[model samples]
Target: MKKKKYNTLWLSFLGVTAIPVLAIFIITMVVARNEFYEMRAIYGPNFIPATRESILMILIFVAGLILVANSLWMIWMKGMVIKPLRDIEAAAKRIAKGDLEFTIVTQRTDEIGELCRDFEEMRRQLKASQDARIYTEQQQKMFISNICHDLKTPITSIQGYVEGIMDGVATTPEMHSKYLKTIHNKANEMNLLINELTMYNKLDMDHVPYDFKEVNLKKYIDDCAEDLEDELATRGVNFGYRYNCADDVTVKVDPVQFSKVIHNLIGNSVKYMDKEDKRIDLRVKDYGNSVMLEIEDNGMGISEKDLPRICDRFYRGDSSRGKTKGSGIGLSIVKKIVGDHGGQISATSKVGLGTTMHVILKKSAGGKNG
Candidate 1:
């Protein structure tokens, strides 16, 4: 190939041209010693003889040719190396300027070539990570804007209704009662926001001690579901379960927090169901000594792109905003509880199909799997 030939030529030029020129200079000096001495003896009386000048001119011309050839060879060698380096540098500059699409294609399989490959790979990874981070930040900002607008609308209405009542504009008992209930509802919404914020702050603290105990997980999940069944039924949501674990299947965790995890997941499933017979199913099974709980829902399922980040604090799928209800902290709290209990939680969903959340709780206390 042309590339192989070019590489071979550069290496040959470096070794043959540059190195031999150096050797010639040494050889010429030794060979011309007697000639120089003879010239010196013949010309010293005249000090600047014509014959000595001609001999010196010839030696100077030969030395100049050697110097020029060596210089050319070094320049050629540098071109092979420096060209790729400059290309890498330019690509890096483009990346710094916010272009993530650049790639380096160097032919030589040398250290510089390896360096270029690594540089390109690193740029690709950094761009992917940065793009994801920017998207997340934008989503967070939008959510905050939406939350602010949502909260402000109800609060403003409540304030106006209360003012009207105080100003004696509420003429009937029914009107007064409706206004009071509206105020109470808005106040409850504000309280819910405050509680969510408080819980989020607690979770953000890097290390919060969790008091974990060995829990009869099967019994616990059944109890939690039973407690929430009436609430779900009132909202036209049906709940079912398939418990395949032994009667004594257990896991080490804080019972209250573990209950909260199950509670939040089930609540969201019931709240967001889109089908006529809105349903959520919880299945528990034993994997060796560990326990696995899966919650499936026939709801407006999350998109694949958004599923990965659902557990992030304050993150809610944009599509779910109008259809679902919560402070966006429920899943985040569940993730923290599972993490503290030294377990793993993951979710899979299709846009129109449904969602399945898998929580794996280990039996041993000292080791955790992610």
Candidate 2:
């Protein structure tokens, strides 16, 4: 038979309780039985009967003592060892079954208590990791859903326009031009969405392909503003530019990606422009160690609730930004571009008024002032 772990302790205790009592009974029996006649010769004939009764009493006492010792050991083992192990075993089984919600507790200041604490810590970390995984999964699904929604609109329009053209619905030359133009625009929109998604994914993975060079802040802003002016003018929206920075101050940035940053910011502003006379102001200011570029607009502003999360990826849940159907990664792309250049982007806005986007970049020490 396989002896339990506590049996060793029980046997050790039996050495003191049962063994000694048994030894005493054996010794008493031998001495009483062997020394009977000698003691009777010394004392009286009645000693034999009395000695027999004393032996019976010793046997009873030893048996009772052994029984009591076994009983006490059983109770001690149940309370101190067996019950605690059973509790831990049950908890382990629950956790093995993927039930991380249960808790393990220990009041003793022993090794078992330390073991329980470690188990609890492991459970907590497991729960946290599971939650993070679930959140990532949800975000991925939302990304796919949002991308499909944005792509379907332009795709559907392109398909309809192509069908119209095939059916000869545009009978006149002007109608033909208009139908082809609409198809071209829809295709362009789809292309832009695809490009934004690709860029956002790259930025998210920190796989930036930048060509950093030191350029004069003043000159760069001026040239960029000129381009922005011409572009926005095409849409009948005015563009304003100002430079309040030192002429010699320079900053390192990837010109192409930085241009995208400007465009994205301006694009977001244009998306919400609601006034009859829409205008976007681009301003650059010197701040000793760094320079700040601000893009302000006279468009319908972002709500306070939306402003904080406007730059989050796939964040089209806002009331204002949702007014236009987009991939919702515009601000995310802008934020990533600015961050990659060791800069920060922020915004300030009021409902029904306008919004200003501020980007801060560290100034390069010395460069040719263009």
Candidate 3:
């Protein structure tokens, strides 16, 4: 389309320029014919005055031709080149003044049109970058605010517990022990928050170290589930495990970091459990090239709106916030760890039904059994 328009523009300019030149040619021919006949009739093939008149007529005709040509050239240039350039200049000025909304419209197929298209693309990219920067700034501010509040909650608790112990309020040994334990728990929470912050910083900086190893998936998850079984049982939650893989099924992973992933998911499930038949199920399945680990729970599920952002740093679901305590970076850390191990994680849930967390890891080349 633009190519056709460009060709058409050149053709039109040629046509416009030809019309005046053709008119001037006809006028000069008529003047020369009249001068020839007038000189012959008036002076009988005269030499001096007739020659003077003819010279004057020729000069006038040349001047008129020059004037017409100049006028037409100016008109053509203004329409084809100057106006578009002026538009571009004006748009540029507006952009310099921080007005990104200005648009440059052109119908030329020449260099100027290409320039306009490039300028538009640049403006769009700038706008997108500005928007992303603003969003990131807003998110950072919100994170800082939430971190301060989260830290304050535990710090305030620790301070209160310490004050109680110092004031002789816990005169009994049991009371003293309880207060000290509370203080310890609060301190632990603060430490966990700080640790999560540090881990997130490392992840952001691409500096989190991993020690990858090939391990049997069945035994690995079994051990993890077994470690949590006692705790779940003590809390009256039925725990179940299913390993639907061959005996030799294995995956390469950083065991410690991967274990953190499992722990965080199970901890989240336990924290949100509100069912009469409280249950946590751990399942492992072997795909041809990968293994899947799923931890599901009969807990208060996440809303559809909140499910997508659950793994984002410091994003706490409204339902989970009131019933449980968390540093809000656990799932984010889990996601980062899974990603670093060349795996993926996702969650599926329906409100009031249950939530299932899935982790998919590539199978190790050496599928050695435990």
In candidate 1, stretches whose alpha carbon ends up further than 4 angstroms from where it belongs are 1-72, 91-101, 322-327, 364-370
Residues 101-175 of candidate 1 have per-residue lDDT tens digits of: 766776668888799889978988998998989987987787687678667867898889989999988899999
Q: Tell me each candidate's TM-score.
A: 0.78, 0.70, 0.75
- Model 3, residue 240: distance off in Å is 1.5
Q: Is candidate 1 or candidate 2 better by TM-score?
A: 1
Please give the ranking of all candidate structures by lDDT, highest first, separated by commas. 2, 3, 1
- lDDT tens digits, residue span 26-60, model 2: 88888887788788788887764566887788788
- Report the error of model 3 at residue 304, Å: 2.2
**Which TM-score value belongs to model 2?**
0.70
Q: How many residue pairs clash in each candidate?
A: 0, 0, 0
Q: Considering every candidate listed, which one attains the maximal lDDT?
A: 2
How would you encode candidate 3's per-residue C-alpha lDDT over 93-152 as one tens digit per residue?
A: 887887787666666578978887888888888778878777768767777877788889
Residue 282, candidate 1: C-alpha displacement in angstroms:
1.9
Give the TM-score (vs. native) of candidate 3. Answer: 0.75
